[model samples]
Target: MTATPAIEGWFTTGDQPALIGERCTTCATSYFPPTAAAAGFCRNPRCEGTEFEQVELSRRGTVWSYTDTRYQPPPPYSAPEPFAPFGLAAVELPEGIVVLGQVAAGYGPDDLRVGMHVELVVEPEHTGEALIWRWKPLAEGSAA
Candidate 1:
């Protein structure tokens, strides 16, 4: 797909795509790609008995780490011939969870930083079957 397709009922505003996740009721921990059921346990031992509740994630976060994929990824990830490198970043959300995703098209290491703020976005993969989550640098004057 030339543009990302929304996963129905996942994001708050379908047009502004986001990753799906869940929050633990007991310890307030969050998970990416939401757990399969509501009765999931928290990773933290003190809150192991908590149940996860589906929730929309914050659109903004600070970069926690980053890396690049210089070679073609195995099946499942589609890349055109002469495969160019793609960036990956781990972002720390407001609720204290870190989410990893690819960087949005046109962004490179020069435009990223460990503590820099970024906003979550979705981009359609070249294969046209799924929407991939990505991150973009937050606008200079925008609040994180």
Candidate 2:
């Protein structure tokens, strides 16, 4: 079966992947997990912007905070039997926004720390039939 993005248009896939966001045409504010609309007004309280453009966010970011998911999520989520806990993180990308997502497989809270660099990666969801974005911690001494 072909792997497909569980949530289409939220991100790109390949060697270098990035989250797709919307940039306000007038104020230039960026939003991740982008809006469902093709175009709309900006949300900035001080900016009266009325248009937005699609933009790809930085592939790398710093871990602002993180935690473990102790309980299995409820439906329509299909949790595995004897549910396995996973790490979730709120990463702050270079664009000055915080985006939350799951940590890459084989990694957990023990593998993360505040201010550590991470790269965007795509992985199959529980069913292994769809893809989703996850954060992978950058190795120490390696370029982010």
Candidate 3:
């Protein structure tokens, strides 16, 4: 059987890539992947907000945390046989939100830092099925 495609329509602007999330019109809190359920309320109790509007996130953020997967992930995540380890990271957006995604291939943990600026990138699926999100170092001297 072929693999299922991941969520669609979740893309940053092609020219200047940035994570896209939804902002609560009432409370002003933002969320990634644009929450679909009513449970998308802002965490701030004082606001008790609803109504999210699509918002483009800041292009750059510091590395908040990270890890590497040494083993192959089960079914839903397709990987070639004799799977190689991949890097996973939690990047802190300028909006104060942390987003989790894969680190761009060719970079390793040694290349990362807790406060290094990184930009979002959409990579082709090696397995030929889904689109994957990854983070890469912003070009030197370029504002993210």
Candidate 4:
């Protein structure tokens, strides 16, 4: 069976993967997991526009904050067997939003720091029914 996103429409899966967000045509505000239906209205109190466009978000961002998961998460979350700790990061993209995601395998809290540059990557989940976005720390010498 082919893998898919656990929840559809959150991101793109291909040679160049990106988180999909919506940009308000009127006020230029953006939203992730994009607003739909009547919720599609501009979030900005000043703008009344109801039009929004899909946009591919930046693949790189700085680590705004992060943490380690030492224990198995509750139901609906597919935790790895034996439950090794994993890192989670809240990265601030150039678009001015902070998106949270799991850090790439082989990484943990010890390997991360505030403001560290990171890039997006896609990996299969434990169950294999989904492919998920992960964040990888960029090389120290590389500029984001």
Candidate 1, superposed: residue stretches over 4 Å from native: 1-13, 36-39
In candidate 3, which residue ranges exceed 4 Å CA deviation?
A: 1-5, 36-40, 139-144
Residue 27 of candidate 3: its Cα lDDT?
69
Q: State candidate 4's TM-score.
A: 0.92
Tens digit of per-residue lDDT, candidate 1, span 69-130: 87899986568787988889999989788988889989977788888889987776656576
TM-scores vs. true structure, each candidate: 0.82, 0.94, 0.83, 0.92
Q: Rank the candidates by TM-score, best first.
A: 2, 4, 3, 1
Give per-residue CA lDDT, model 2, range 1-144, as digits (tens).
989998999999988988999888788889887882344567778888877888999999999999999998999988778899999999998888999999999899999999899999999988899999999999886555
Q: What is the per-residue lDDT of model 4 for residues 27-68, given as tens digits with 9 covering 90 to 100?
A: 887777676425957777888989988899998999999999
Candidate 1 residue-wise lDDT at 136: 93
Could you tell me which 10 consecutive residues in candidate 2 have the lowest summed lDDT?
Answer: 36-45
Q: Choose the strongest candidate by lDDT.
A: 2
lDDT of 2: 0.89
- The positional error of residue 49 in candidate 2, measured at the CA in angstroms, is 0.7
- Per residue, candidate 3 scores C-alpha lDDT tens digits across 101-143 of 8888787666777777788877666775765678886655655
RMSD of every candidate to native, in Å, equals 2.8, 1.5, 3.1, 1.5
Output the lDDT of residue 73, model 2.
90
**In lDDT terms, how accurate is model 3?**
0.74
- Give the 10-residue window scoring lowest on summed lDDT in candidate 3: 1-10
